[model samples]
Target: MMTNLQKASLFFLSFLMISIMACSRELSHDDNEEEIIFKEESSTGEPEHYQAVPNDLVLIYDGGAHRRIQWGKEHFAPYVSAEVNGEEKWLFDGFLFLEIHDGRGRGFASGYQAMAARKTEWENLLENYFAKGNGIHALNEQIEEMRKTGRVTGEFEKRKVVLCIPEPIPNQTDWGQLDGRSLQFFRKEDRIDACKWYIDFAEQLFQDANFEHVELVGFYWLAEEATNSRNLAKDVADYVYGKKYDFYWIPYFNSDGYSEWRNLGFNVPYYQPNYFFSESIPYSRLQEACDRARKFQMNMEIEFDDRALKNNGWGYRLTDYLDVYEKNGVFDSLKVAYYQGGDAFYKLSQSEEEADRALYRRIIHLITQRAEEGVD
Candidate 1:
C-alpha cells in the first residue's frame, strides 16, 4: 500500500529494508529527537503512520571482488515497506541502483560479450578477473524479475544498474588504490580506440529493456586513481564526456588529485576521507575537504566500509562519524554519496551487525523525517 508520492521520496537503490518502524520495530539505538516514532495513534481510534523514505539517490554494489550480495539483500530489502500516514508504504524505492557487473571476477561478466572482438584485444587483463562467463544472463534474470514486477511500484518502471568498466590505459605498472591490474590492461596508442569501443558497448547493454529506468546516471570508472599516480588516466575525462557518461570514481581524499577529478569533467567524483585516523578525528579538516567538494559541485562518498573495514582498521563508529557531521549540520549542505549501501554490515559480528543495522536504519529514518519536516 506504499503510495507513489511516499515512494517517490524513497530513492530506489539495491539495499532495501524489510521493516522500518521507529515506534514499533526495536532499534539498536535511540534518536536524539523526541517522539520519533513510526505509527501514531489518531484521536479517531486509528494508527497514523509518519516515517517517510530518506535516500534521494542510493547505490548498492551487489557485485564484489569475489562475492554476491544475496544474503545482505535478504537481510535488508523487506524492512523498507511499512504503513505511512495511515497508508502502507515502501521507504526504499526510487533511484536505487544495483551493481550488476564490474567485468571483474563477478557480476554480469558475460556482458563482456557486447565488446565482441574488442574483448580479444585486451586479453592480458587479469585471468580470474576477466575470464569470460554467462553472468550477463544472471543480470538478465534480475531485469526480468524487476520488469515483471515493475520493481517496487508494480507500474512497469525501469531500474538503474551501475556497470563497472575497470580498465586502465596500457601496461603502466603502479596499481594505486584500485584493482587496476585486471581493469587497466590496454595496448599503447589503442587507448582512445578502446574508450570508443566500450562506450558503444555500454550504450547497447543499457539500452535494452532491463535498463529503461536509467537516465543521467553513468558508469563506475573502475580505475581508482591517486593524485600523484604517474599512471593516471587524465584523458579519460574527455572520452567520458564525449560519450556523455557520468564518470563515478572513488578517489582518495588525501591525494592532491581528489580536488582535480571534477575539473577534469568526470562529473561524479566520490571523494573518500582517509585522513580520519591521521589525527584525533580532525573534524575541521574533514569539513574543509567536504567544503572543497561542495565548491567543486562534487559529492563525498562515505562508504560505511570507512568505519568497519578491518583492512581499514575496523574504522570509527558510525555514531562518532555522524555526530561530528550532524553537529555541523553538513548533511544537507554537502552532496554526500553513500557509495554502496548495507554491505559493510555483513562484515560485522552478529551483535555488531544488529547494532550497525539499527543505527543506519534510524539514521536514514531521521534524515527522511528531517527532509520531510524541513528541519534545518
Candidate 2:
C-alpha cells in the first residue's frame, strides 16, 4: 500500500509540469503576434527606402532663368514628390541661373544691394517651398522629406540631387568683329576683370546666407572665339579652386575641343563629350577622354543632343547610347545627360509602345548592371 505522502508528492509534480507547458505555449503565441504586427506596420505605413543613392543616369531638364525661389517652386518641387521606376529619384535643374537681372532702371549697384538685402527672404522661400510639412532645410532636407513620405514607389533604387550653374553673363562686349590681334588686346583687361568679379561674387554668396546647400557649381566655359578654351578653363580653375571649390563640368568633343580645354590645365570631373552619330567621333577617342578624366579622379558625363538624336532617325533610342558607353568599359561610372526632357523615359503604370519599351529595357539593364558593379 502506498503512503499518503507519496500520493501528494506525485500530484504536485504533475501540476508543475502542466504549468510549465502552459507558459511555453503563451511565449510562442506572443512571438507570433510580434511578427504579425511588424509585417502589418511595414505594409500599411510609408515606404522606408526612398533615401537611397540615385543611378548613374541623372536626367536634368533645363529650367530656364528664374529667381531661385520661383524656379524651385515651378521646377524642382513637383519632381520631389515623384517616383520613378519604383524608387524615388531626384531631378536636377540644368541651366539654373539665379542672378540679379535688372535693366537701366536699377543699375548694377542698386541691383546688387537689393539682392543682398533680400537674401534671407529668398532662402526661406526656397526652404519652405521644397520641404514643407517635412522638417528639412536645404536641398538635402527635401530629399529626406521624400524618403520619410515614401512618395516614390516602383522599380528604381536610389536618389541623387544635382544643380548646374552655367557661365554667368560675360562682362565684355565689342558689338562688332575685330581682327584676331586687336580682339586679343581689347578683351584681355575685360576678361581679367570679369574673372575677378565672378570669383568675388561667388565668394560673397558663399559667405552670405543664400547659397548654403550648393554642392556643385558649373561654370560653362564657352569656346566660341576665345583664343584658347584651355586657357580660359585654367584661369577659371585657378579662381574656383583658389576659393576651395572642387566640383567642375567641362564640355568635351573632338580632338580640337578636348585638346583646347586640356591645354588650360583644367581637369574634367564630369566629361560632356558630344557624340551624335556612331561615326562622328571614334569610340577610342571617347574612351581616351574618359580614361584621362578618371586619372584626375573625375567621372565622365556624356551629353547627347535631342535634336541630333531625332535628326539621325535612329528612332531616338537610348540603347545605341548605352551600347557605346558599355563598350568603352567606363559605362559603370559614366554620367549620361538626357537632353530631350523627362518624357523620354517612362515610369511604372505608364505604358510605352513596344519599341519604346525595348529602348527603356536596354537603359534599365545597363544601369542595373553598372550599379551592381559598385562604382560610385
Candidate 3:
C-alpha cells in the first residue's frame, strides 16, 4: 500500500534525526569537560575572566622562626594526594607561608608582639620556611614525590608559593636598628622603607635557597585590615609591583579596607568568612560571606582547625561550610584560600578516628574536585 519513493524518504528522515541526537549528546559531554576559568577584578574594579589565576591558595602558617613546627614530609604528604578509587590524586596546588608570632618577641601584627620582626628574626623565618638546613625542603620533597609517583605532569607539576611580608608595626625600635640606616617608623617614609627591605630580603633568601619545584608567585600583607595604614599599604604594594611581584591581601569579614582592596593596590584580595572559629556567628554567615565574595568580585578564605576533630558542635561547622559553599557555587566559581589552623588538616589526615578521616576525605574531595575542574 506504500509507494517505494515515500518509504525511502521516511527512512532518510529518521536517519537524519538520529544523527542530530547523537551529536547533541557529544556536545553536552564536551561542555561538562571544559576547563573551569575564573573572573578577576580588573583595574576598573570589574570582573574579567583571567585564565592564569591560581585556583586554590592554601595557607601554610605557624612554621616560622623559633617554632618547632617543622612542616616535614609527613605533614605535606597528606596535602599532596590520597587514595581515591584506588588511585592517588593530587590535592592543593598553592602554598602561602606566613606566621603571626615567632617564638621570640617579634609578631606580624602589633597585638601579637611588642617587637616587629628584626633582621635576625626574619633570617630565621626564611630558613625555616624554606627548610634550608632542616634536611627536607618541603616544596622540593613534594615535587619529588609527585614525579616518582607519576601524579603530576606538564604545568600542574610545578607548585606556586607566596611569601608573607611582616607588617611594619609602627614605633618598633628595630626599625631604626635594621641595616644601620636609623629608620624611624614614626615617619611615613621609614615604614615604606622597612617593607621594601623585607621584600628585598625575601627575594635574596629565595635565590639563595635555590628551590627547584616551586615558583615564587607573590607576597601577602600580614595585616588583616588596613584602616590606619593606607599610605603604607599602597606604597608597599607599589614597591612590590615594581619588583615584578604581585601583592595580596585577605581582610577579615567586613573589616576595614575590605571594600577598597583594589584602590589599596592589591592584585588579589580574598574575603575571610570568619565562620569556623566563632560559636556565636550563626551558620547563615556563610551565605552572606559567599554573597559578599561574588558581589565584590573577590576570592574567599576557608577557615578550619584541629577542633574539627572534636566530638562537638565545632565539627559541624566545617560541614556547614562545605554545604554552604557548594550551594552557593563557591567551590566551582571562585578562587579559594584555605586557613587551616596550624596543621589541622594534616592532623585530620592522620587521625585514627573514622569520623575525622571521613571529614578529611570530604575536604580533600572538594579540593581535588577543584583541581580536576581545571585550576590554574
Best by lDDT: 3
Candidate structures ordered by lDDT, highest first = 3, 1, 2
- Candidate 2, 195: how far from true, in Å? 2.8
Per-residue lDDT tens digits for candidate 3, residues 1-376, read: 3332343355446544533433221121122332322343233544332224567777888544565556777678777667665667777777888888787766666556645666567666666776643322675676676768776433455577788887777665564455667777668888887778778878887788777776777889988777446778989888877777778789887667788888887878899887776565556566667767776777888899878886643677888788777766677767788888887888888888888888888888787778777633
Predicted structure 3: lDDT: 0.70
Clashes of each: 23, 9, 0
Higher-scoring candidate on lDDT, 1 or 2: 1
Instruction: Tell me the lDDT of model 2 at 71.
Output: 26
Q: Model 2 misses residue 84 by how many Å?
A: 6.9
Root-mean-square deviation of every model:
15.2, 28.3, 18.7
Q: How accurate is candidate 1 locally (lDDT)?
A: 0.41
Indicate which candidate wins on TM-score: 3
Error of 2 at 60 (Å): 4.5
lDDT of 2 at 366: 53
Q: Write the per-residue lDDT of candidate 2 for residues 122-222, one digit (tens) a residue.
A: 23322332343321124444554555676644333333333222222232132112223222213545444444454554444434534233333333333
Candidate lDDT scores, in order, read: 0.41, 0.37, 0.70
